[model samples]
Target: MSPRPPRRLPLGTATSIGAAVLAFTAITVAGLGSFGAFSGLTSARLAMLAAPEAVEVEATLARVGITAETLAAAGCSSGDATNVGADALAHLDTTNWNALVSADGDVRDAQAEVDRLGKLVRAGQADQEDLTAYATAKSTLATETSTRDGLLDALYDAAVADLTSGETTLLETMHGNSDRPVPLQYTVSDRTDAQWTSLRNALANIKTSGMCGEDPDTACTTLVTNCNAETEVATAASNLDSNLAGVTSALHTALGQE
Candidate 1:
C-alpha cells in the first residue's frame, strides 16, 4: 500500500506559518525593516504605500483627459485625427452653410415681392406707399443678411484658429519640442515594461526556508511544505503592490512630474 499522506496542521498553526512566510518575504524583498515604520509590517502592508502616489498621478493626468486607447486610435505620431479642435471646424462649416442658404432664400423672396410691387406702381395699379414698403423690407433683409454673414465669418475664423492651436500643441507635445507635457501613450509603455520586470525580479528573489532539524517529525515536514506554498501567495501580493507602484510612476512620468 502507498504511504499515508502527511496530516495537515491545525488551522491556527497553519495561519501562523502562512503569516510568518509572508512577513519574511516582505522583509526580504522590500528591505522595509530599514525604514523603521515598515520594520514590523504584516503581509503586503507595503502595498498601501503606493496609494498617495497613485492619487497624485491621477490628478496630474486629469488635465488632458486622454487615455492610452484614445492615443492609439488618434495616431499622434502620424498626425491622424490628432487635432482635437478640428471637429469644431466641420460643425461651424455646416452651420454657416445652412445659415447662408436660409438667408439667401429670405433675400430672394423679399426681392421678388419688391419687384412685383414696383411693376404694379409703374402701371398705377398700386399705391407708391406699398412699393416703398416692399423696397424698404428688401433693404432691411439685405442688411440683416450681411450682418449674419459677418458673424458666421467670425465664427469660422475662430474655429480655424482653435484648430491651428490644437495642432501646434499636439506637434510640440509629441516631439517634446518645448515645455509641453508628453503624451500619455509615449511615456507609459516603457514604464509598464519596467514595472513587470521589477515584479518578476521580486518574485524570483523570493527565498523560502523551513525551520526543520535532522530527524524532523512528519508534522514538521508537512508544516514546512504547506508554509512553502505561502510563498506563491506572498509573491502574488508583492506583484499587486509592485503593479500599483509601477502605474503610479508611469503616470507621474506622463505628467512630467520627474
Candidate 2:
C-alpha cells in the first residue's frame, strides 16, 4: 500500500480538541482565582479569631491597673491620720505612688491601641503592621502592670507593718500600766452611780468597736479613730501610773522613809 497519509484528525476532532484545551485553561484560571480568594478569606478569619484574645487581655490589664491604683490610693490618704502615720514610717510619697499612675496611663494607652487594632483585625482591615503594634503594646503593658502591682504590694505591706507595730506598742504600754490606780478627788463610794455607769459604758464601747471592712476610706478612718482611742487609753493609764507614783512619794515623805 502507498505510504499512508499521516493519519489526521477529522475537522470535528480538531475543533473538539481546541475547545477542550480552552475549557481546561479557563477552569484552571477560575480555580486559581478561587484559591486566591479562599486564601484571603482564611487570613481574615485568622485575624478575627485573634481579636477576642486581644480584647480580653486589654480588659484584664485595665482591671489590674484600676485595682493597683485603688489600693495604692487607699494606702496613702491625706485626710486619714492613720494612713498618714503609717505612711510616715513607710515613707510612701507621690513619687512612689506615681509609679502606679504612670503604669495606669501606659496601660490605658496600650489598651486603647490594642482595641483599635482588634477592631481592624475583626473588620479584615488589619495589616501586619497593626498586628505587630498591638503585640508590642500588649507586652509593654504587661511589664508595666506587673511593676505597678509589685510597687503597690510593697507599699501596702510596709504601711501595714508600721501600723501593726504602732498598735502593738500602744497595747503593750496599756497593759504595762493596767494595774495603776486612777487618782480620785473623793472616795469611790461617793461617786454617783450614773458617773460609774458612764465610765463603764465608755470602756465597753471602746472594747467592742469593730474595724471597718471593704471600703478603704472607711477602713482608714476607722484605723485612725481606733489608733487615737488606743493612744488615749495608753495615755490615761500612764497618767494613772504617774499619779500613783506621786501619791506613793508623798506618803513616803510624810513617813520620812526617804
Candidate 3:
C-alpha cells in the first residue's frame, strides 16, 4: 500500500502554528526597531544633559585665564603703599580723654576747674597763688592732651602699617598663584580667597570712630570680591576634566555600547 500520504496536520493546528511564527517574526523586527529608536533618544538626552555643563566648563576656563591675567596686571608686589593715607585714617584711635577719670574726676571736670580758676583770676577774685595754680593746671592739661594725641597717632600709624603689610602679602601671593598650572592655580585661588575673606571680615568689623566712616577701604573690598569671583571660576574650571568624563560615561551607558 502506498505509504499513507503523510498525515496532514489538522487545518486548525496548521493555521495556529503559522500565526505564531508570523507573530514572533514581527515581534523580533519591531523590538529591533524600538531598540534603535530608544538608543537615538538616549543619545539626544545625553547631549542635552551635557550641553549646559560643557558651556559652563568652557566659560569657567576662560574666566580662569582672565582672572589670572587680571591678578598679574594688578601690580602685585610686597610692600605696596597704595592706601597708606586712607588706612591711617581708617585706623585712627579717637579715644575720648574727657571721658576718662583718674582720682580727680574726669578730664572734663579738670577742664571746667581750669576755666573757673581763670574766670576768678580775670575777675580779680583770686590771689597770686591761686592764679599761679590755675596757670600750671592749664599748662598740664595742654601737655596731657598733646601726649594723648601723639600716642593715638602712633597707634594709628602702626595699625596702618600692619594693614599695608597684610595687603602686600596677599598681592604677592596672588601674583605667585597667577602663574601656576591651571589646577594648582585653582587650589591656590581657593586658599587665597579664604584669606581675603578673613581679611575683609576683619576690616569690615572694625569699629572706627566714624571719622572715615565704618566701611572698609574700597580697594580692599574690591580685592576680596574679585578674589572670591575667581575662586568661583576655579571651582568650575578645576572640575572640567572630571565633568567631561562623567558626561562621556553617561552618554556611553545611554547608547548601550562603550
Candidate 4:
C-alpha cells in the first residue's frame, strides 16, 4: 500500500515558523522536545519556499520578455535585452524576495501590454501594406498582455499555496525528519534550472511561432536572449558566493543554465 500523505499549514494562517523557532528554542532549553514548537515541518516546506522564488522567476521572465518586446514594439533590431535583465536585478530571490510579491495590478498590467505588442511586432504579425491588420494586431496584443499581467497580480502570493494547498490532515505525527536547513543554494539552483527550462521553451516557441523577428534560425541563437537572462540571474545568485559554494561543488559553475 502507498504511504499516507503529509499535512501543511494554510495561507493567511498562523504558521510564523520564525516565532515557532524561538518558542521551540525555549522549550528545548526547558528540557522539552524538539517537535513541539517547530511542528509539522516536512519535505513539503521546500515547495513553500520555492513558490516565492518561482514568483520571482515569473517576474524576471516577464521583464526579459518585456524588454525584447519593447524593442520589437519600437521596431528596432537589436538583441540588447539588457534593460530587461537590469529591471530584474531589483527583485531577485537572491536577496529578500518576499518584498517583490506585493506588486500592484497596474504595473503588471502595463508589462503585460508590452509583452503582447512585442509578440506581434516580433512575429511580423503587422504588415506595412495592411494598416488595418497591423492596427488590429497591435491593439489585440496590448490587451492580451494587460490581462496576463492582471492575472499574475492576483496569484502573486499563491506561493504559500504549497503551505497546504495540496494537503489536508487533522493529525500530523512526525514519522521521520531531518533538522537540516533546506540548502538555499540548492533551491536557488533548482529555480535556476526551472527558469532555464522555461527559457528554452520560450526560445523554441519564439522561433517556431515566428515571434522573434527575422533571424538565421539556429538553436543557440534562438536561446541567445535567454542565455543572457540565465547568466544575469546566476550572477545575482553567485553574489552570495559563500552561502552557496560550500553547499555543493556544482554551485561553482553555471552549467546547463542556458
* lDDT of each residue in 13-48, candidate 2, tens digit only: 335433543454455455656566545443222222
lDDT of every predicted structure (CA atoms): 0.39, 0.40, 0.39, 0.34
What are the runs in model 2 whose C-alpha is more than 4 Å off?
1-85, 88-90, 163-258
Backbone atom clashes (below 3 Å) for every candidate: 0, 0, 0, 1
User: Candidate 1, residues 166-256: lDDT per residue as tens digits?
Assistant: 4334322422311123222232222244444543343333322223323544554554344335543343334334343443344344433
lDDT of 2 at 121: 84
Query: If scored against the real structure, what TM-score would every candidate get?
Result: 0.25, 0.31, 0.24, 0.21
RMSD of 2: 35.2
**Compared to the true structure, candidate 1 yields what TM-score?**
0.25
Across 100-190, the per-residue lDDT of candidate 3 in tens digits comes to 1121123345568789899998898999889888988798767655554344334334323644343333333443454343333233333
Please tell me which predicted candidate would have the highest TM-score against the true structure.
2
Question: Per-residue lDDT tens digits of candidate 4, residues 91-207?
Answer: 344333333322322334455655666666678784664455556655665665455444333232232122231111100111111111221111222234455465556556556
lDDT of 1: 0.39
What is the Cα-based lDDT of residue 130 in candidate 4?
Answer: 47
